[model samples]
Target: MPLFKRRDGGSIRDRFEFRDVLGTGAFSKVFLAECKAEPGHLVAVKCIDKKALKGKEESLENEIKVLRKLRHQNIVQLYDTYDEKGYVYLVMELVTGGELFDRIVAKGSYTEKDASHLIRQVLHAVSFMHDNGVVHRDLKPENLLYFNHEEDSKIMISDFGLSKTEDSGVMATACGTPGYVAPEVLQQKPYGKAVDIWSIGVIAYILLCGYPPFYDENDANLFAQIIKGEYEFDAPYWNEISDSAKDFISHLMCCDPDQRFTCEQALAHPWISGNTAYTKDIHGSVASHLKKSLAKRNWKKAYNAAAAIRQLQLLRISSSRAVTGNSSSNGTPPNRPFPV
Candidate 1:
């Protein structure tokens, strides 16, 4: 039973049956859809107007090509694409939960443990992208999505409209979410993948404090604050978080791009060390770590709690399938309602 229903019998290229709208942005609109050939399978169809792709068609094509070649658990998966009559549509995985921004807004702020877990997953996804020669110029909460419900969601980095594939070279595009953009990017300097690390640091700050480290009513003042690297933490929030977590963030947020920690190094930090109860492996691997961390305070406790909830949810979804389903024993379906 899909949550959204198809619209007006409209179909993309006579293949994907358009369900309800998922979301809309400046250049495109996303819809939850089903492939006519594959009835129960669900996907996200991004419909970009031909007018919007006029000057940037090549960039959009490049993003599709790059995403097609990339396959990782942490990164959003692209299934298919087509350009019909006048519209360009990209079919991708339907991460059911929602945007990461919603969760941060709801919680006001996250604990240090939660922040570390989320950052680790983002790092892993970015690291995989960099390894494939793709640089995600846009790294922000809005671009990151949860695959399931908020408490036990898998974070998947999405929206590659501004992404580019760089073969060991620097990119000059001054593009990224405003508050999360790095100083070098703001200065229009040729930058490398390190810019992603800077954005990660900003995300880390927001996750722990409910707002960015540098914010101002005026855009100029905001840029100045970021350029100067001026930031601080209030007592209670700062105290509950571990010193190692703070050190790790400071390292990632280094003003000098050359000095900032890489994704690999960040994963090795002590703040993220320990076994995750929700995952099979110890320390939970970067992606699973973020999901499990958000579900519980301690890794072990959270893992166990998530597992229990998943079992219950599965039983509710289908008792017969709950006994035979091959989906991960750890995750719960996001579309299913859960008690707060």
Candidate 2:
């Protein structure tokens, strides 16, 4: 159940007429619903099965808390939540414009300037989150959704399942998608909001080149590359990308969180704030690479980077217990790394 219950004694079904299913997951289903008071107005309602969420109740509650606190143009809005006997319902903004990469790939004339504008919007939203003490632990292409199906649709960051509030204290949990996750996160070190900046850097790199910065068939190798902050602007693809654009990414993707660009710094970069980002059409190259990379789609399926992180976390726990000679009471890793 959510920390706070706004709806006193009514069901979500009382206000919205549930329609077709938009999508489904292991323990939840998203349905398109129409507001009863306002005809034709639609919203997506996520119905989560309480029984299936046996061990993940806190995760659901955290997502609700974070989403409730966030109010930004680029971030998905949470309208209302309901707790039922068998399920929990979340009413959210209906974003029909699909994924960010899908829109980019479908565009005919994508450019560095266009990518810069997109990143600027994202930075603005993230800056607001940071200011509000919220950190979107996961920021990947899949989590970014278009507000509408218009040609000039704005991007909205969705899915706060892994998000955390500053009040949660120093976050050391190795979370977030593998390719976009920061080095500190992979190293199991205490981290802060700068991790989100690293993810934006990875997204910016992919936006310019249509592929991830660090990738390998082997999960360990990929984590090692990210841990070392090893990536390059390859020839041909990046030959035409502006120097300012590369500089922007380098600052955000820096190995050291302290050295990495903050959201404000990134927003003020020439690439985003100035006109240094080139207008040259990079769609052909970027789209071609995007199709070829299959990118994190494959990685998300075939490899479990989170599992590797969990293994590392487990190793650390074992080492600490050995040094302190305090056996774990439950015989299980504590605070198991949040699902990535």
Candidate 3:
């Protein structure tokens, strides 16, 4: 049985006609729907089968809860929801603009100043989320979207499947994409809103350059590197990036969550305030690397989502078994030195 009651209503289809499929994932299908009363306005309705969400109802419900109350210019808006016998549907704002990376690549000229502006907007949204006691556990390029196909549309943060609200305080779920995840999360430590800041730092590093700060084919190796907070700005790609830009990333990538910058602090940083002249167009170089990066999508990404869920389960089981907090307690030592 669903945790929440369906708001009294007629056939959902009578009021909202599904037009076309927007996207599909393992748990849900997002469709472009037309409103009967406001036919001119179209909304994206995410349909999730109750059977498919048998074990994951908590996450889905938390996502709906967060989306229902949280509203920001850079965050996708949830219009309404319906709890039918077979499935639940969440109606959201329809955004036509493409992914953030694609939009940057399409631009003729992109620069650090441009990157700062983008990060600033993301920070504002994240700041608002934190203020409202919500943490977006999964913050990545794929989750960032533009409002429209317009050249200057604002990026909206989408996909809250892994989000955690204040009610679930000091989350230890260990759920999120591998690369952009905070080190504390990788270590399975009790974490708070700072995880979102770490993710923003990763996004900032990518926005300025075009590739992730941490990249590896070996999952263990990648996790170890993240644990150590080891990363470098390689030649050719990062040669032109400013030190201030790197400094900004450094502030957030600290291994200790206590040392990382909060969204408010990040927003007030000099880089976002235009202290450095990062206006020189890095689009030519960045777009080239970005194209290759996006096309050669990491195989681990598909596996990581499942792995995160498994990791979560393992953690729960371990807690029941009273396993030590140290990652090494599981026998696979997480402290193994990362290959340089």
Tens digits of per-residue lDDT, candidate 1, 1-340, equal: 2112345445464777788998897789999888888899889988888887788777787788788978988888987776665677888988987777566545533445666677778888899988888888878776788887758687999878678888735787567765677777765578888889888987886665454565443344445555556566544435555566678789888878998888888788776654321221222122332343345323222222123334444445322332343432212232211111
Which candidate should be chosen as best, given TM-score against the real structure? Answer: 2
- Per-residue lDDT for 241 in model 2? 94
Instruction: Indicate the worst ten consecutive residues by lDDT in candidate 1.
Output: 331-340
What overall lDDT goes with each candidate model? Answer: 0.66, 0.82, 0.79
> Per-residue CA lDDT of candidate 3, range 1-340, in tens?
5445556657569789899998898878999999998978999998998899888777777888899879899999998878888888888999999899989988989989889989999999999999999998889998999999887889899988788887866688677888888877767778999989988888888887777777665455556657777777666577788999989999988878998999888888899876683789999877877887777665445654338546555555332232233232212333321111
| Candidate 1 residue pairs in backbone clash | 6-19, 277-303, 278-303
lDDT of 2 at 196: 97
Instruction: In angstroms, give how far residue 293 of model 3 lies from its true place.
Output: 1.4
Q: List pairs with backbone clashes in candidate 3.
A: none
Give the poorly placed runs of model 2, Cα more than 4 Å off: 1-8, 294-299, 302-305, 311-340
Which of the two candidates, 1 or 3, achieves a greater lDDT against the reference?
Answer: 3
RMSD of each: 17.3, 7.7, 5.5
Worst 10-residue stretch by lDDT in candidate 2?
A: 330-339
Segments in model 1 whose C-alpha atoms lie over 4 Å from true places: 1-13, 104-110, 274-340
Q: Backbone clashes per model, in order?
A: 3, 0, 0
